[model samples]
Target: MLSTLQPLLGLGVILGLAWLASERRRAVSLRLVLAGLALQIGLALLLLKLPFAQAVFLSMTDLVLAVQRATQAGTELVFGFLGGGAAPFETRYPQNSFVLAFQALPLILVMSALSALLFYWRVLPLLVHGFAWLLRRTMGTGGALGLGAAANVFVGMTEAPLLIRPYLAGLSRSALFALMTCGMATVAGTVMVLYAGILSDTVPNAMGHILTASLISAPAALMIAGVLVPEHPDAADRAIVAIPSTSRSSMDAITRGTLDAIPLWLNILAMLIVMVALVSLVNQMLGLLPTVAGEPLTAQRLLGWVMAPVAWLIGIPWSEAQVAGSLMGIKTILNELIAYLELAGTASAELSERSRLIMTYALCGFANLGSLGIMIGGLGAMAPERRDEIVALGLKSILAGTMATLSTGAVVALIL
Candidate 1:
């Protein structure tokens, strides 16, 4: 009884706080808060607590594990002899240091190739179309907007634009915003694997939680984006957004997807390399800052301080709020990948259960600066005419996307 009632109490608190913050816009604020609560229960029952859902969730984990294992064969074949036979979970040891997120960045190329092959084989398009169908019906969106949003859940922001290539010129401003926000708000299927590997040990069901966060946030993204900047007049007036392209052939898909994954893989590699270097530099520079007691303030420390208020706003306990705030800041400014990496690096067993659960949902999406650039570039490329609109809307979209993820966090906080 207490376990069940605790979530409801949390929900009530979140709704009350959000309502107070937007007291002037009480009606809209209340609705958004309620929508978040609804999502929390829906996800908890259907995806987290249900047996069939658990089965499906585990399948994703297995599928990811297989892909990671198979794709890393070359690396493993060469290096496995040195330490491959070691404990499978040894990767969790901070001392192991070498992470597969960078190690398997190349698989982006492989998966892209596979995606292309699936497109060519017509399998990918059908999967995309089917999901698009759900979005259209569930969100009252046109086929094009639905496909674009669904694509973001699976592919990178830029790659997702390819699915709606033909319809870009026809979309209304609102639909276009939804498309970009979706990209900013969800992880691609490929990196989903990377995060799964990163947090699998620490969080037993990390994959399921990450997948659920992405899926639930789709509608939340649409809701927030539409509110931020209403859909273009033309789009609101249209019956359906047009779908783009016939399915590609298998051979052509393999060739194309591999080519497509190149930039994605490089981006991943570059992000990790640059971010790691940057963090190291920051640590060194912070060494000179005034020491508090024996420890000088650092970026993570400052971010923790700045975000602690926001973390509390989300209803995390005061003791853990600073840590949660730091996670939120890292995820927004840099990327969730780093946030998860750091979260896992911490002695999480020492963290309160509520903090662990909240971080799980909070760091679950792609709501970061990198993804903003991603949405701008991806959508801009799709409809060069809308380049200005995409750029102008970037900040607003980021705010909405951030809120969309928070809406998910708010939901998770309730359930926790």
Candidate 2:
């Protein structure tokens, strides 16, 4: 079926684009990337179908859901009277379109506070420890670095670095590359609620799967980041050192987390404004193009045409490949948030279940250009010396990040 071919199609298009991004089509580098993808595909199959791996996957999925459920308790406590998970406020006002829990800004706020509390209580780090242990053993990463990389799935990108803060200054180039790529590849805890809100109508389990994608991609990111630039000198002999926890109290933790989350909230709002405007501008320009039949297609559609092969490779049915590939391309170039809004319009009861799951995983990542900047800003603030290096690696990180998310989608696609 064409749906099956989409994955191969997507891989070819994306890799071709990546090589073009490098501004030269080097055959050797292309071969290396092809080899890397082969390794990624192999690892994905082994992890997904293996009995022991599936057992671990199940336990991890349960743990993520349990955290989500516990986190929801806080949102309910404060807003239940206002219908946190109850019917939309529209039921009360009749004219209001907003559904508080499903709209989800408040949940982001509540989860941010509670995520901090969880960190203060060390509840999450223990969970991170178990998952990171798997990464260290299976993927050949140093334990301390692996811990930070894995922890990013449940925490903020910048915050994760603090877990391995002691080892960062000393991390080999590859570990540092893996570290930076992981930041760009995984979505943070704060936005998980926001995205769940965005995709609520189409797929209800967006949060859980987003969480799962982040976890699965963490090690995938390590593998790819390591491949691109092998650790200068592998930190093989170095022992993994844990960073000391730094919250004075739960209240203090909540306060600091809220402060950290403000930019995230603002960025989401700002990105929505600029990206929507730019998309409209692009669409308008493309509308001037000569028509093929009787209708003029927009630039987004042009992108859909250019990138359609990728959508197919990721398991999108041939019928939807043009549209689906465009959406995936939009998510990578723009942000997942915009792609989700676009997906909301695209998703309907009519979409196939397999297509639906692929969409969910495809939209799960921090691979957009804006995130590359966020990595620069966040990591730059921590180590001013690494700003140039961060900036230099920015584009490659987006590619690695996209590959990481696709790698997750590939696994989920196989399962479907």
Q: Pick the candidate with the highest TM-score.
A: 1
Residues 1-416 of candidate 2: C-alpha lDDT, one tens digit per residue: 55455566665555555445442333223333444555456655655456465456546545545655665666666666343456543465643534433333343444456667776787665655565476444555566567768667766566566454435566665667778878777877656767777777787566666666676677667756765655433463253445454779989988876675555445444544565577668767878888866877765456557766666677777787766777777787667877877777754453566776687776688787656655665565555576677678877887777776776676567655
Stretches off by above 4 angstroms in model 1 are 1-40, 57-133, 193-204, 236-300, 345-350, 373-389
Tell me how far the alpha carbon of residue 239 in candidate 1 is from the true structure, in angstroms, after superposition. 10
Error of 1 at 207 (Å): 3.1
Q: Lowest summed lDDT over 10 consecutive residues: which window, candidate 2?
A: 23-32
lDDT of model 1 at position 50: 68
lDDT score at residue 344, model 1, on the 0-100 scale: 83
lDDT of 2 at 179: 83
Give the whole-model CA lDDT for all candidates, comma-separated.
0.63, 0.63
Root-mean-square deviation (CA) per prediction: 5.8, 6.4
lDDT of 1 by residue, 1-416 (tens): 54344444544553444334331442243343345346545865677666588567556556655765666675556556232334455455654655554344444555556555655555544654565566444444566677767656656666666654556677777777777788777777667767878888787777777777777777667666655555443454252433433435567656766665555555545544655576658767987878976887666667667877666655566677777887877887677888888878783754576677667776777766556655654456446688898888776676667666766666666555
Go through the candidates in order and give the clash count of each: 7, 7
Collision count of model 2: 7
Indicate the residue-level lDDT of 101 in model 2: 36
